[model samples]
Target: MTRRPNPFNQQAMEEVLRDLGCPESLIPSTISNYRLFVPLLFTELGEERVYQLVSRTRDELTLGEQEEAWRSSIKYIVAWAETVMEQYKHKRSNAPKSDSPDDKQPRLL
Candidate 1:
């Protein structure tokens, strides 16, 4: 299968980030940095979640001028984070309780 160029190539991201005042030293050397970086947060919010966040931000920027695009992107990220937090909280609350014998209190002789 033919490989398509990554839409958010490293150089492009570096340029944009530099323009926005991110220190040149802090910019990642490649897009793969981001892909691998997300896993360090937690397993539940892994690479897939990071990809979804980037994709949503890209889609959100198509709505209008530069200022509006940035404004909308910020709003989108805030909403997305809230939704993810809620889903995680719900999932944790619904998880089955552990029933291991090791967790039971020991009887006094």
Candidate 2:
């Protein structure tokens, strides 16, 4: 089954990136590549932890430290996304198959 995209999270992440100074031209690809996984990350780690991770990208710390923090956070999120996707695929593959013909069609009285 194909998964539907979530427009609300997409728009919210775009706004978050804009607030963090992401360029206009990069928003679409960035949303697909990075920000789309944010909802899952928030679900797995909670809003406060995810917010703290994102907040590091905007901190006024030394440049290298900030970059390191941002990269590490992104790495964590990407890894988690991969793991979750894999688990979803595995569970879907293991789901029980319908055994009755009626399971595939609605009955009419």
In lDDT terms, which candidate is top? 2
Span of ten consecutive residues with least summed lDDT in model 1: 35-44
Per-residue CA lDDT of model 1 for 1-109, tens digit only, reads 5464564576777777788887665565334456444333434554456445556776565432354555565455556655656676689699878899986645523
Task: Estimate every model's Cα lDDT from 0 to 1.
Answer: 0.57, 0.65
Residue runs of model 1 more than 4 Å from their true location after superposition:
1-65, 101-109
* lDDT, residue 72, candidate 2: 70
Cα deviation at 19, candidate 2, in Å, is 23
Instruction: Tell how far residue 40 is off in model 1, in angstroms.
Output: 13
lDDT score, candidate 1: 0.57
| Candidate 1, residue 50: lDDT | 46
Q: What is the lDDT of candidate 2?
A: 0.65
How close is every model to the real structure, measured as TM-score?
0.33, 0.35
